[model samples]
Target chain A: MSSASPFHGLSAFPATPANIDGRVDTEALGRLLERLCEAGVASIGLLGSTGIYAYLTREERLRAVKAAVECVAGRIPLIVGAGALRTDHAVGLARDAEAAGADALLLAPVSYTPLTQEEAYEHFLAVAKATKLPVCIYNNPGTTHFTFSRELLQRLSDIETIRAVKMPLPVDGDLPGELAALREKTDLAIGYSGDWGAADALLSGADAWYSVVGGLLPRTTLGLAKAAMAGDVDGARRLDKLFAPLWQTFKAFGSIRVVYMLLEHLSLARAELPRPLLPLKSADRQRVLEIVEPLIALEGGRKS
Target chain B: MSSASPFHGLSAFPATPANIDGRVDTEALGRLLERLCEAGVASIGLLGSTGIYAYLTREERLRAVKAAVECVAGRIPLIVGAGALRTDHAVGLARDAEAAGADALLLAPVSYTPLTQEEAYEHFLAVAKATKLPVCIYNNPGTTHFTFSRELLQRLSDIETIRAVKMPLPVDGDLPGELAALREKTDLAIGYSGDWGAADALLSGADAWYSVVGGLLPRTTLGLAKAAMAGDVDGARRLDKLFAPLWQTFKAFGSIRVVYMLLEHLSLARAELPRPLLPLKSADRQRVLEIVEPLIALEGGRKS
Candidate 1:
């Protein structure tokens, strides 16, 4: 897979369910993945940032990804996240992900920076070289705290198998200008990210949205994607209006936990998240339900 | 181990050495631990924040603690860091660390927070219930991006196993005056973190110092500790002067990467840090060396 090898469209990073003892709720996670895949998820990006991969050990992560890959059975792209804070470990993850039948690797650069571009390039090159599978650069400086400069992205694009970028829009900066400039400079396939920033990113020309929101509301994502794909900008606006309130109400609890709550509300899985990260608070949960209730009800109404 | 356990004096978070391929530089690491023990390190804290525990997988972290425990041969108290964004995993690490011969644990309550005191208290309580070993509640908001407020600390103090606190000087607020008042309400073991705030904390009635600086420049830390312990403020001040300029250099590359670099400079074994984090640059190395030149040379002037 090269830069143009089309893994870009809509992707969802489904949450990994775990028992209270911290054992992977493998059965529940598999069900969640199957639901998304059955609902026509374009790609199942296992162990992505939103998957809480950082909190899970490498072995657990490998196990989850392998299970997802086996369950999905190559129906959609299985893009395993291969971003570790260290080069050797990231390479190790990439190598294992490849062995486990991951279709592509979404690699984030060394997050703790003031990383020299050379060091960042070397990290990607090492991970890219370690695996024969395609690698997409996931540049979400907002979380990873590091961004790949267009020049660095272009340098990475030089590798034959390097493909795609999942760029999260920086909160304080303008995304459209940056994406336009970045798109102009590199042949790297670009996708947008952040639930709150998705519509703006779509309007600005990113080929897909890294839909964390999609994992919670697959049909909403599909409806929005259809509207955006057909250049039906007004219809896209309507979907955004319906779904965007979620980004605000749940913003208090954080994207992951809020999404996890939404999943619980949707009856997809148990509400238990790993501790250090608790499930939504009762007061917050009540507020979240107030917001999530209507959007879910709207979906119910649409389906009817 | 209950929260009421008495803790006193210094505890050292020893570093793990690694080979070039990022495998355990076990021989080097073993030697370093033995050297630290021989130097009268009161407690051996492995895989704590200072030990880059976050950068290691569960297996790797377990292996490291086991290696350190074996090398030290029970010569010192063996405390392991068992904190992650996931609480259950933190408990698992605690149980494993104890099984591997750790005397205690240092727990950091982190990962996606807005966590109420009730949730944090429950988190600690759950970990306390899971492991047999006494746990040191790590309070470093600087890294975790969440502070354990005094009221929360007071609530945590009620727990039987939260015997100690690794107080990182607050990032914004003044060093724990009200918290110190709150501290008076409980008999918790109080230790000053060695993260550049040691001098002030020692003055503020904190017991002992767990210094990464000690891991690098033992001469400086030993001298500083001795002076501070003796109430010889001027003697501690002299050593503090030598350590001051070297402080911000590592902040440029992050504390862990800098720790590895300092290990390299000390001619102790060091290797690549784990992913999302990158290795230090040549310029960073050069600058780090330049900043610590006087301090590195201080060993030569030591009467020992």
Candidate 2:
């Protein structure tokens, strides 16, 4: 795990601010990317699950990638998510991201029909082979619903361009043990999402924190990431405690909803979550405000 | 439920045959629907799960609806699946189905974010309000991953256009009890999918069998459906026994995979299952063939 590797540190996943009609607000998105770059996170995970990649159109996704590529300007690695329900569509998305100048690809087996492991393998193979960019296997079953077996992960690790995996937090909360098992099996750089688990994951020697909050509060999230990565247990726990309230809100109402509300409250963007995904109710939003306001103040009082 | 309701009796869902690019082969699709019409199924579920509704684009889906409406020519009610991950997208799809001449809409709370029951309610309400066509709530947790609470179903049933529900077979397998409980709560016609359980579901007094096998072997499935719905316990069991081997294949391999293989073997269409959904392996296909060939013969052999 090197600093230069996009998979090695705090990889900030920003929501692709889009309208109710699913049109990407490229300017708003560019502002979010700029914040990530300034904060000097390891990478920008654009169009990830938190970014609503599943909800946006390919044309809109391409536009977001192009804007991100321009806005980041080689300051940060832009890992674009290229997940789609159809493998061919994912392949096309990967190619689009590559052609539009993404530094790497993140592909989840975004499935409607539940996929067999072999099908997931073939899907990843097809997409990785379609682009020269390195690919990270997105093993988030919460949204995709396709769980990868260890054997399947080992098989996927053999793909030349597949260099990393973004895994969900293990159910039993055994990061160190899970990391040891995964490390023994495959040489792919391993990272974890589930923002609340970041301190433990990094402290346990995981390579990266794929952070949703990092997208909005990059500097504060980076502070926590650095402390954990440097083996500063006390410092990391202190920062982690600061995030506890926000984490509770994330658990209570999905992290995506919390992040979106924070983005709006910080006045970074006024984007709507694509519908069926509603904004937090007024009461919920007020609760989130109360929880995050102090954290935002500690986060240098919001850039905007 | 009246016989005139598309929710009543056997609703035969058919695969929407398409090229590798997801360009719906409307002519091929028409051929599949024509068979369902000639079989005199109670309704033609043109874009149900087996139809690959989630895989197709809105334009392709609308083309499929137009083709089915023309081909079926009102002989059987045409039920179009108007489900999308986004609520606005679903509303658009519902409007498309209505404008393209679909008789009824099947709305699944197709989710990428796991939806709250209230979110699911709002999604259904928006789509139902968007179209004049009667709507059937598609409660398929297998693909959608959003389970509807009984209360949410009751709430959706109160919406004027929301006329029915297509439920997954209960986990406890107590169809009689589940159906009786649901009947107590709402006037909405209740149906069940899961082809292997269709006999028991219909026999247990479910208003409809949203059958996947009914998509391919309409006559054979109709035989089982008719016997079961008519309260012929012995006759239904006898027909169901004939289907036991086929049902075993469906359970072993997903019904979609088996249905596509059966379609090709019957020479109805040379359509491919969209990528990420690979064709069954040769040995598996051979096994499927061995299981279904006899059933096809019982279906009076292939039409084309």
For model 2, name the residue pairs that clash.
Answer: none
Per-residue CA lDDT of candidate 1, range A259-291, in tens?
777766777777466666667668988887777
TM-score per prediction, in order, is 0.85, 0.98
The 10 consecutive residues of candidate 1 chain B with the worst lDDT sum are B1-10
* DockQ, candidate 1, vs. native dimer: 0.37
- Give the Å error, residue A60, model 2: 0.9
Candidate 1 lDDT tens digits, B1-304? 1222224555666666655444566677776677676676556667776677766667878888778878875466777888766776777888998788777888877644345566788888989888777778887755554567677777777888777777776556465583467567766778877457777666566776777766666655677777776777888788777788777765556667777777766666756565445566688778887887788677543222
Task: Give the range where candidate 1 chain A is weakest over 10 consecutive residues by summed lDDT.
Answer: A1-10
Runs in model 1 with CA error above 4 Å? Answer: A1-7, A21-41, A56-75, A99-101, A109-119, A141-154, A282-287, A297-304, B1-9, B20-27, B57-60, B66-75, B110-119, B176-187, B258-297, B300-304
TM-score of 1: 0.85
* Local accuracy of candidate 2 as per-residue lDDT tens digits, A32-114: 89888888999999999999999999999999999998998568888999999998889899999988888898999988888
In candidate 2, how many Å is residue A144 off?
0.4
Model 1's chain B yields a TM-score of 0.88
